[model samples]
Every structure is written in C-alpha cells, then in structure tokens.
Target: MFRTIFNTVVIAACFFILTALHAEAAGFKDVPKEHFAYDAVLWAQKYEIINGYSDGTFKPNEMITEQQFAKLLANYFELEIVEDELKKQTTTEIWSDEFYNSLASYGVPLNGYLHNSIRSQPVKRGVVAQAIAHLADAQQNLNSSIEFLLEHSISTGQNPKYENRDLQKFFGSTNNMTRAQVVTLLYRMDSMDFYYISDDAEAIHKNEDNNSLNERAIEAKKQLDASLQQNPSSSNLWNGNYRYVYQWGKGQYERNARYVTISSANSKDFYVRLSAYDGKYEGTTEGYAVITSAKKAIMQESIKGNRCIIEFEHLNNAIKVTEIDCSAERKNGTNFSGTLRKQ
Candidate 1:
C-alpha cells in the first residue's frame, strides 16, 4: 500500500507541473486562452522570443519599432551585432553599426528603412510580411509579401462595411502591424511549406568555396579586370581634381567645388582628398580624406565624417557617379545624382 500511494502521488505531481507550464505559456490576462493567436504567443514566450511588460501583460496591440524587431530576429538567429562594423557605415549615430550589418547579413533589405530617421517608428505589416517571405525564399514580386500572406490563408481581405460603419477595414499590405500579429507571423515561419533549409548541397558547396580569403581576393581581382575591360583605362580618372554638384531630390543641393583630388594610386588603395560646401548654408564646408578603388570611392562630410558610398563609372574625361547613399549626412530631399568631371 505504501509503494502504491507513492507512485500515485508522483504521477499527480508530474501532471500538475505540465498543466501549470501550459497555462503559463499563454497566461497573459489580455490574451484569451482561446484566441487564435494564443498558441503563437505561447510558442514565442516559450522560446524567449518576447517578454511581457512589468505588469505581466503582453500588450498585443502595441506597435513594435524596426530596431526592436531587428533585435528580436537577431536573438532568434543567434547573430551577434558587430559594433565596429556599424560605426563604419554611418555617422547619423542614431543606430549602432551592428544593428544594420547584422540585419543585412541575414538578407534583410536595409534599403527600405535605412535612408531615414524612421527606424524608430513602428514597422508596417507589409514590411513584416516581406521579411518573413524573404527568409522563406519566396519569390519577391512587388506584392509578393501580401500575396504570401493571402495565399497561405493568414489573413482575410478588408472587413465588409456594416451599417453605421463606413470605414472599410483592410488586411492590406500597408496596415500597421501589432505585436501579436508580428509574433504570429514569426511563429508561422516554421511551417513546413514556408520554412527555409540551409543544408542544400549547392549552397553548402558555395559557402565552403567562398570561405577562403584568397578565393575572395581572386574574385575581386576578376571583377576589377572585368571593369577594366569595359572602361579600357582608368589612367586619367584619379590623377587630378574634379568638380561635381551633388544634388539629391528637390532639397537644397551641395556645391562640391573641388570634390576629390587623388594623391596616389595603386592596386591596393587610391588615396584622395575631398571638399564640399553646403549650397543651402553658405560657408558650411564638408571635407574628407578617403581611400577608394578604381571602381568606387566613398566620401564623408568633414564636419562629422559620416559615410556616403560612391560608385564610379569612369568615362573618357569624366567619371560618372552612378549612385550615392549620403542619407546619413544630408537632410531629406537632397538630390543623390551627380557627375564628376576633370577640371
């Protein structure tokens, strides 16, 4: 009888422990136990992907920022943010370099959110969908993310208008995403049809082949050779001073009177000095001492020395700057297009 009672008691204790764990998994008072998102909430909490507020409430409707979501994804993937790398990217100093680099490394498109001060703003639902779709290797169309959600039956279309309610509620692409919604989407990422596998033999082989520094050097040399073939000669491209007006959008332009003066050149580095004046604000000078390559040059404003990525397309007497990302240094509305010509 004593042995029988002990065994029964142990069994009962085990049952209680499991029941308590299930309850704790989705225990937020605000989230009903029978809510559709209850299981996803439980899964996220179980794996520490999210935490509740100090008051023990998971405010499901609260919006999440890009940085916050990025951090959560970083935690999920076990990627470490490299602070030094982020420092080298921008001087806006709003977000750490690691925050940007880590997201880029994981295939997140920084172009959508990197150009503005809106990184701290709440992320939109469409963007959340895009992130998930990209991770799942889904083909990205203009509406791919929205289509992914709809095709998977994750959301229904806009709610039908009812009497006395003219506002048509939509599950459209640009809707603001709530915390619960984002978590549910993340939970669904593990579904068999949506999950991405990194174990493909071709991918593994490519990764292994690219692992060597020597191999990367060789690839870069090949690119340089290819570029040289197209341009034929970069002989006069870097030796003298060039003047270019850096205009971005409809905003006040920058007067770069003496933009870049190359001092020396080699296969390793092309050292150059740059100078510019803010067209909107006279006497405001921005200068930079930078080392570039035959194919690309990057310059930062002298005041803070933030970064701007410059890609060069060398012509006979002029080097056309095809693209520039000077978002960190310039105010909104500055035109990003410009040309550099030998003076």
Candidate 2:
C-alpha cells in the first residue's frame, strides 16, 4: 500500500513540473517557441494584458490602431477611466470614447493622436514611447519620454535621416508599430528593474520603480555648460539633436512636431537636416549652412519662385526655428518654427 501511494505522488509531481516548464510556450499557431517575442507573449498572456484572436492565432504582425492601443494601455495599467476627466478638444474618437478621455485625463503626450481622423489612424511609435515613459515615471513630454526610454533599456531608435536604414527604429519611427513589438516592449518593461548607464552600453536594472533620478539629461546639460564655458559664443557647438512639440486648437492653432539634426561640423558651419513629421505628414530638406554669426544660421530655398528663408538660432540648451514663407513645404498644419530642446 505504501509503495503504491508513493508512486502516485511522484507521478503528480512530474506532471506539475512539466506543466510549469511548458508555460513559456504560449499556445498560438503563429508564435513559435523560437520567436523573439515568445517570452513577452507568454507574459502578456499570463496577465491577460493582450490576448490572441478567437481563431487560436495571434496575429502578431497586425498593425495596431491608435484607439485600440490607448484602450490596451488603460486596461494593462488598471487605470480608472473616469468620465469627468474630459478633454475639451477636437480630434476626438467617437468610438471608444472612454479610452480617449482617459488618455487626456492621464496627461499622456498627445503626439499623433491629435492628427485628423483619430479613429482610423494608427498610433506612431512616438505615442507609444510617451505613454510608456509616463508609466515609467518620466515627464509627460515627447523629449523627456524619448530620453527615458533610451536611458532605460526599453528601445534603441536612431533617426533614419542619419542612418542608412529605411525606417526609423524605436521612438523615432513614423511607421506603424506591430502588435508583437508592443508586447515585447511591455514584457521588457514589466521585468525591468533599474536604469543605469554602463561603460559597456549594456542594459542594466536595479530598482523596481526606478525612482532614481535620471542622470543622462543632467550629464548632457553639464557637458553643454562646460563647452559654453570654454567658448562663450560658438555656433559650432550647436551641433546636436534638438526637437520640439507644438499644439493649437479649433482651426486657429498649430499642432505639429519638428526635429533637426546637425552633424559633420567644422569651425565655420556644419551639415543640417531639418525634418518635420507627424504620422502621415512629413517634410524634409538638407543643406550646408555657413555660420555667419555665433548663434544664428540661415538657409534659403525658393518655393514656386518665392524666396523662403529658414533661420536657426542657438539658445542656451535650446534651438529656435523661424521660417519666412516656408508654408509651401509645411504639411498637416505643421510649422517648423518653435523652441526645440536638446535630446
């Protein structure tokens, strides 16, 4: 009798162990065990954060819509979608009204969401970065959110204008993000512990909340300050990544984003690539600027025989853009003139 009971117990234990080991294999026709997002898919499944389709297939490659993403985030975070947290604005999605309201109430950066046809549009990766950064305790702005993701091991995005790649990776990508990519991001975030800049440039984590103050932005500021001290007024020092976000309402405002890249610098001037992007809208022009002053450089282009001038001004930790009749190049109500902060 004793031997029979012992054998039964051992069998049960073996079954339990096998079940536990197979948990990571998330049962989906499309997701194989060797898939890069397998672990994330497993985690998302465990938490019911994102689920597969009814046909027993996870369409991991499907493009996620903006409203759908917003709702997914709200549910994943278990945020209270209060009705009173309403945002008085245009570009509202009549469907999934709660999700849109929650996004506004939560103060998540409204990057491409504010663009027209909010319901049918796909959310940009920048929007994803901003929302995730907010949850990770970063400031509620595009630049800060982007810096947070980079500082944290969440993403690696290099502007395509500089890189040879066709599509921008990470937060800079204007392309629509896939469902699997987002799931992988969430999985990394949930398992991430700390944010530390290592000498080897590898991902490191320590604290759970990551409340430790971000030192990268601090270090960058210090470096710029030191450079300024060395040369009080130098346009050559202005070669760095800078971006800005602007918003306007009710047919009377400007809602857009601008990014400028300056590189390959000499003492006199440097190469500049000015790009404007907001989901479906984009305009780009690159040219060499000969520095005529310590804080300003101007580029001239003729649009339809009308001379258009673009000015770049170097300020302390910021770059100011001023355009004279560059409207022909602007799209989706984007104005390239604004105060952009260093990333």
Candidate 3:
C-alpha cells in the first residue's frame, strides 16, 4: 500500500513539471504558440517590456497609448527618471503625467500625446515611428525621423514628404497602433544600437567643462554617423527649390530657371522640374536619374528630340552636370552643361 501511494505521488509530480514547461512554450491565452507575432510578444513579456492583463489575456488586438509605449521604452533602455514615486496607485502609474514630464526633460517627446488629458488617446503609427527613431539617436524633426524609418526598413518603399498636421495622407501614419504592432516595433528597434541620457539635462549638458560628458557626445556622433552611412541619405536628400542655369555651350545662353523644384523619393531615383523659367527654351525639360553611388548618378534627358546622357557629380551641396553631346542645335546625342544650386 505504501509503495503504491509513493508511486502515485511521483507520477503526479512528474506530470506537474511537464505541464509547467509546456505552459512556458504556449505563451499568453490570446497569443497562441503559432501566432506570427508570438516570438516578439513572448520576447517582450520575458524581458518585462510588456505585460498581460489581470484576466491572463495579452489582448494583442488592443490599441496602445503613446504614454504607455514611452514607459516601455524608458524601462527597456533603463532611462534614469528624475521623478520619485512610491504611491500605491491603481493601474499603470508610471505612465502618468509626471512620467511624460520626466521623459520630456530627457529630450524624449511624448510625440503629441502630451499630458494626462490626451494621454489616453491611442498613439498613431506616425507617432510611434517618430518616437522609435528618436530613441535610435535620429534627429528630433519629422523629416529626419521619417528618413530614419526608411533607412531602417521600418517604413518600406519611398519616404514621401507629408505635412505633420496632415497625417491622414501619409502612408501608415494615421492608423491606430495595436498592442502587437507596438511590441513588434519595439522588438525591431531593440535589435538596433540604442542610447539614452538621464532626465537631469542641466547637470550633464549645461556643464560644458565636463570632459566625460563631452567624450560621450563625441562617441555618440561617431555611432550616429555610422548608422547614417548604413542606410545612406535618401535620393530626396537633395530635393528642394533650386536656382539653375542651362547653357548651350561654355558661357552660351540657353535659359535661366528660378525656383526649379527637385524631388527624389528614394535615394536611387530622382526628378527635376522647372517651376517657372525665363529663357530661350519655350517648352520645358524634365530630367530624371538613378543615383549609382554616393558621388555619381546616371541621368537621361530629352530636350526637344535631343537625347543626351548626363553624368552628375556631387560637388559640395550642389550638383555639377556635364553633358556628352557637345554640338548645339540638333543631334540624337548632343551634350550640354548645367549647375544646380539649392535655393
């Protein structure tokens, strides 16, 4: 009888251990082991980057707020908060108004989420993308953040320009982010090099004589430059209003165009258009090119049936173009020359 009782207890103990191990692999109730975001979600949970509800459901479909995500990043990067709190508040108190204030002190914008009033609103995709970019040491401006997203492959395809207030037109910018989406982005961002500073901005930055702080800034710049080279600037890096002169030959008059608009969505592709012109060319000439490298681009343009192959070389902030067809007035491959200066 004693032997049988001991045998029963041992079998139960073995069963319990096996079941416990299986649960770890199974993950949260809503997120099954086979879910596509299972791995990322599991990673976040394991590292205490995110949490499930009291009901034991991960609620992967629920929308996430900007403040909520801010806390997650703050905790993930171990950003030293300047606030002190020991209150026994309900729910997520760390993601409160004080938390955002603390983050802003560290140059971390809440990304339009602001304080406790609008803090409950769901964070838009654009906001999350921008915040993640800032965490990676990208510039705080919207353009740089968008470019950072393009470089990191977070936002695929062309990085088109969009007004900050006009978020609806921007692709993937206006959508309300789901919990799974937030976690997945965090997972991707975590894989990159991240840097942060304490919320006490006055101590480190204001004290210019601090050698250690200056060294850190130098190191940070080096790392940022390395990251920039990895993606390379977008072809649109040079896009903007320009003042250009088109000459038939050396010092010969062709036309002078003011406010020429140059636009390139991706680093490898580009477009140039004359907004308003005052010159001999009655019609218009539109040129497009494919950037071959950091310093060279292959351009093609046809001006009134004149086909020319133009090569572009990066000269400081401006681009110098040399045309192959030297003879003027009519040839299939007539060359010309021009200079474009950013306005």
C-alpha lDDT values of all predictions: 0.49, 0.56, 0.53
TM-score of every candidate: 0.46, 0.46, 0.46
Candidate 2 per-residue lDDT, tens place, 262-318, comes to 643456766655666554466665666666787887766532343446788889878
**What shift in Å separates residue 181 of candidate 3 from its native position after superposition?**
0.6
Runs of candidate 3 with Cα error greater than 4 angstroms are: 1-26, 84-95, 111-114, 155-170, 195-343
* Candidate 2 C-alpha error for residue 13, in Å: 3.9
Q: Give the worst 10-residue stretch by lDDT in candidate 1.
A: 223-232
The predicted structure with the larger lDDT, 2 or 3, is 2
- Candidate 3 per-residue C-alpha lDDT over 1-343 given as tens digits, one digit per residue, 9 for 90 to 100: 9999999999999999999898575458668777767988988887888887653557565456555777676667665665433222123444454555444434443432222323444565656655566556545555566667666765542224654543334545554566787787667766764434333333433435543422433333233222121112345455543445444543223444333344433667665443323343322345676788877776565434445456666666566666564233233223345677753
> Between which residue pairs do clashes occur in model 3?
235-267, 325-334, 325-335
Residue 65, candidate 1: Cα error in Å is 1.7
lDDT (tens digit, per residue) of candidate 1 on 127-244: 5555555545543432555566767875445545532342213444444456787778777764534544223312422445444322332232232211121111233235444556
- Candidate with more favorable, higher lDDT: 1 or 3: 3
Clashes of each: 8, 2, 3
Leading candidate by lDDT: 2
Is 1 or 2 the stronger prediction by TM-score? 2
